[model samples]
Target: MPRPLDRCHQHLLAALVVRLPPSLAALFFAALFLAFPALASAHEVGLSRGDFVVEGASVNGEITFAQRELATFLPGLDRDRDDTLSEKELTDAHDRIERAVIDRIQVLGDGSACPGRLLFALPVEGDGVTLKATFSCSAPPGEVRFEVGLIEDLAFNHRQLLRVGGGPRVSEALLYRKRKTLTAPIAAAVVARPSAPAASASLPSAPTPAPEESAPSTALDLFLMGIEHILLGIDHLVFLFGLVLLGGRLRAILLVVTAFTVAHSITLALATLGIWTPSPRLIEPAIALSIAYVGVENLYIKDAEGRWRITLPFGLIHGFGFAGALQEIGLPRAEVPKALLCFNLGVEAGQLAVLAVWLPLLAFARRRGWLTPRVVRLTSVLIVLAGVAWFVERVFGA
Candidate 1:
């Protein structure tokens, strides 16, 4: 068997023979190598969690937000200028953090806006800072509306996992974009209990309702959400673009796409159902690496032979990435199957739509001689560069 380095050289020579001019390819590789030092920043998506309970005329809750997210609201929170935050740093800025949290999160009860009073602010063991607060309404509210505006101006992709409950009725939602307010009705009146001792931030215990009583996400909502997620996810789209850059016949294209769909579907279901889940911190960088691998492979592998080998494993990684989004948003345990099915269907629809538009344009380019071998090589190089940038950003950049 050929040594790994020998195999790599062979692949490079094969790739050059098929498409890339040797001189141009060498120059492109040299440029990327020189620019590697500057690509050390990491990229991340903003996320927060909120759990609220309604009792009588009072709404009490805790919102756990990342320390980095809190820095966006109050820059001074990170006193040492380091990217990482410590407990001492959070304690020093307790008042400012509390004010910011209270100002941004609003709860409306029975059409009247309830004033939020901060109870305590504590830094959790992780990179999270939890703020406990209460909202006092005029009377016992039959319905409550929650609005979370924290980090909205700072991060466009910021999302909040919200869980609200009173009595036996619990509702969960992912808050993003204009879908900030979540309104749910209380199933029964809950009598107010004595306040816990100062410095105690225990969450109120509410019994879980029967599966039938849980508010499940509608099939249409999940379907549309899936479609929207694919359209908005830039990384996933870039990966797909890399796949398309590997020119092939319609049958080959279908086979590659099918492999990706099937692979991701299996992982998506497993991750969504809590059967298996990998941390996003690891998955995100791996995904970028996959994109880089595909782009590099395209440089040498011209035919569709064993292409499914590439798509299958990478598709599994991509599926975990999809699961991260769903996990962040959360799914009702009772409706997991329906939500999973609809969301997967929507993803397929979106992927097909993208291919439908892309394939014909590629064919047109080929027919017109606009897509020369040189152009193909240049495009592949660019894809590789992008993947490298993302990998660096996700792995090291903050």
Candidate 2:
């Protein structure tokens, strides 16, 4: 064999040769998610959730939202104007906050008004606010009607995940401003579903819906959530684009994407199940770093020869990032496995959808002789810059 130094020199010289380019269309899609911070964890400010148990004539529920999100209703909630909420700040806005929250939510029992009381409005960890309320109905709990309308005050993409259970009826709804109601029938349920698996875990995780709106089952809800998440998670998309920038054989591309999928699926389960959860503060920056690193590597590597090796660890990091979002969506203890399974499936489906879009465009470019190393270099530079920017903002900014 040749001397070691000679082999090293040959390898270095080989890396200088030009490689084929990835589609520019993929880069355009990659840059889009960052432009819209409302979609991902820009400030973790876009989504809120509620959990309710309708038992007998009593319906107890708690709703949570980001502190910045609640600021839409009372601009002064954060008196210091910091993104965080202080205990005193919450105490001072007690009455107004309670009124604002409870007014937006209406709980009905068989078409009769169920007068409600705000039990407590307290600050939860992670710069969030939670308001607990109990409604006592004049009528029996035969018919439970719930309506949530926070979207009018919040961003249009802002979603409210509502999960309600009464007797044998358990329904979970992913709600938008347009879809702000959930109505379901139930026998008198004494035990709460969140705490107890009285409702079969075999049933779709927390099922419920708005009247005549054709609500998705919890599985479909999580699947759609996964797809929406990947589409909106610009950094993740950019990283995927970077991995394929060298424009290698189809087998090589599939291998790299498959490695990412398997690696992330493992961690998504671990973090979502409470096995281990690293902070988003750490995970977010790491995700950005992955994107930057991949872009840099693509500039030097002439082919996607060993990309699968690197994407494995980075995909693990990205899985934790995905978990942060799912937790915000709120998983019921009883339906944890179902939620986890459906969510992961949704994520895989989303990944497949993205690959589907990107590969076809690349194929067309190849056929037209439009793909070139120049396009790859330009796109890689942009990706590296974007990743570095996100890393800085996530690490230093709020």
Candidate 3:
């Protein structure tokens, strides 16, 4: 018989031979998952076009926000230990929040971007707090589409839901223009537009009354949202990818995905609907750590059955991270069921989309006999790298 070292070397050689096919497939998937962030960076939420034109008249609009708890925002400066803020504290707090908000804003059209002046004078006062803002954008002469979203990170003690309502009113207007003829003759012609310019109308103003803080929305929505969140969410997606690499049958993959889905959905519903809540400071770190766990596990484990047993439990912690968005969005009062259903449905849609696009490619590669043990080993290493990246970023807040 050969010596122990020789046997080990032989095994290493075998492993090396198996690596290429899976490595290629795994690398391809990694590139696919990365496309999301690239796309997201391009279509960021915010108002881009400076001025919208409505048939020669420029359009103008403004927005304002007020927040309470002006004092607790600063720590060291709160010398009195009183909950209310002093002048020094107020200025400091506002300055910090304002800067945070401004930094998130991206100006569109014009190359130059600058923080607009804060119109602190439009003071709207609420219980123990007062604030206001006024901004205007003009539209040049012509018909155009206008788009805007709340991109500012406004400060508040609790998260608030913002409601956006607007619809265009279809109306017709006649205009004459000089038409070019085939004979090169300039003739005045009147054209009747088929689609009327339905001006998008928005309500003037409304008070944001304190919310009743109802229970969470429908179970379906909560569940679906959890699915969607996991799919698009890069951290969770990376973890799922590791789970996928274990080379399980369709049933096996479903079992693992179902386990993760059920676990996270449970916590997501509970937390978002107000039954239970986890601190962001804690949840964020754990989420990162979960990625590392999956990565490290991939490096050691080669069997499918063993991995599912581990995936089920780790998936529970991931649910809390999914609940983060719903917590912020809050369940809609009148349409709680609808809100929950839609949100969850959106999540499921996203998850299915990812699976639909990637799974077939995976199947094809497997059919080609690409998922050999060597490929698995290389894939595991890549997962480990991704998980380490996530862990470091989260733990250090990088």
Better of 1 and 3 by lDDT: 1
- Residues 1-398, candidate 3: write the lDDT tens digits: 11234888768746755664555755745643442322211101111111111221212222322222222233453556543344445455555544443223332212222223332312221112222222222422122222122222222112222221111221111101111010101112212212222221222222222223422432342344445444546666666677777666778777777787677667756665667777655676666666667766766765456455777777677766655544433333343444445555665566667777767876787789876666666666666655555555445532
Task: Find the candidate with the highest TM-score and give its number.
Answer: 2
Pick out the ten consecutive residues of candidate 1 with the lowest summed lDDT: 34-43
**Per-residue accuracy of model 1 over 150-230 as CA lDDT, tens digit each:** 646546766676778784557777677778889978866678765533365443332234334434554565676677667
lDDT of 2 by residue, 136-201 (tens): 887457878887765676776677777776645467677777788888686754543332222221
As for model 1, its CA RMSD to the true structure in angstroms is 8.0
**Ranking, TM-score, top scorer first:** 2, 1, 3
Q: Which runs of model 3 end up more than 4 angstroms from their true locations?
A: 1-232, 329-337
Clashes per prediction? 5, 6, 11
Off by over 4 Å in 2: 1-47, 66-76, 79-87, 124-128, 186-216
Against the correct fold, how does model 2 do in TM-score?
Answer: 0.78
Error of 2 at 41 (Å): 3.8
What ranges in model 1 sit over 4 Å off? 1-49, 64-92, 120-131, 149-154, 157-163, 167-179, 195-222, 272-276, 325-345
Worst window of 10 by summed lDDT in candidate 3: 175-184
